[model samples]
Target: MRRYTVSTAVTLCAVASLAAAMGPASAFPAAAPPAAHAVQQQPAPPVLVDCLWKPQVHPGDFMLACGDGNSRLASLRWSHWGADSAQATGTNLVNDCDPYCAAGTFHSYTVTVRLDDPKPWAKNPKMQQFTRMSLVYTDGRPDGFRQTMTYPLWS
Candidate 1:
């Protein structure tokens, strides 16, 4: 597992560098690659979590992929293909991770957040209930997992 993690971390850094180097050759065919917008790199040992939105609210699934530690919560890329078909890849993707080697071993991960300046994303009356807390991800493949819990936040 340690070797896997190390290998994945190195690969991600290399891929991130490649992606950055590739530039906007494919994104914008008409315009030359924009130099103003820097290419975003995949973080090293980046652990990530999938956003518990969309069908998860209805289907209730909670599974995540562990990257490393250098990836950002918002930068870890993801995709939901529906009905247990999902895939995510990033660096240092270990939002909530642990070491395990036995059968049926359960691991717990937690993130604590504090309220800062108010943001419009939570201003909507329907979203006000979710103000200070957020559920983000590492690699966003969550098909067989299940939802555990969401905490309370005080304004």
Candidate 2:
């Protein structure tokens, strides 16, 4: 009984050694390559989150004033939306607030908008949000702002 057990073990070891010497190619067939016409899906680009914490890409409008909706970007036509940055041409609508915010008049100005400096949002760690916004006034700007202005966007 002992001799038979030893003989079986030696035979199994010899078979394993033979298989290893033969290599993987002879032991198993190679996998086929992917179809040439198969489309490769790209990853979604980074986004800007609104006050409600909803991600947006190439949005037609975005609210700048989260507290009161007094200022916003309107009619945004995005020229570029990429992982690192985004650019758009739009109208900035700001409330003049001559007397008070409640009865303020909204004014429109033509502007070029840029969003960059992407970082992980606190609310959603998996999502990337643009943390910086820069605007260049092509036409009339708001009373207290320069021709070019940059602001750190909230996460």
Candidate 3:
């Protein structure tokens, strides 16, 4: 056997150690497309409406139905109504927990309601409706909530 230099033996040992640490190349596989079921599409948001109307919304007076009947738009004062959008100040009447929500009293909160431009519904492109409504509370919420309400509009 030929005598190896100390430097040469150290370098070989280092290389072997590195290779062992890296493990086998087969441990890593090539990237593949995600499964079809794993990439499901989200359903469209439900359309909101002023439940107080008879399917006909009056100018300057509209109430947003909270679905639970525990909350609604108590009053609205439109500042402007353009072709694309409308801005208004309003009051959201929400239930106050007196004896729990179902039997609770209602209270009003100052809010700003913004209505976006009409858009064709996904189900029917021919029918146009307000696409979105955004509500911002000007007065501090009694419940300490600080988020705005942005809703999708339908017919």
In terms of lDDT, which candidate is strongest?
Answer: 2
Off by over 4 Å in 3: 1-49, 52-61, 121-127, 142-144
Clashes of each: 27, 0, 0
Name the lDDT of candidate 3.
0.67
Which candidate number maximizes TM-score?
Answer: 2
RMSD of 2: 9.1
Error of 2 at 65 (Å): 0.4
Report the poorest 10 consecutive residues by lDDT, candidate 3. 45-54
Per-model lDDT: 0.34, 0.92, 0.67
Compared with the true structure, what per-residue lDDT tens digits does model 3 show for residues 61-124? 5555546777677567777655466777878887876789888898888988888866654555
* lDDT winner, 1 or 2: 2
TM-score of each: 0.17, 0.73, 0.53
Question: Which candidate model has the greater TM-score, 2 or 3?
Answer: 2
Looking at model 3, residue 20 earns an lDDT score of 91
- Of 1 and 2, the candidate ahead on TM-score is 2
RMSD of 3: 16.6
Question: Given candidate 3, what's the lDDT at residue 146?
Answer: 67
1-155 per-residue lDDT for model 2 (tens digits): 99999999999999999989887885677777887668776657878998888999999999999999999999999999998999999999999997999999999999999999999888877778899999999999999999999999998
Model 3 error, position 135 (Å): 1.0
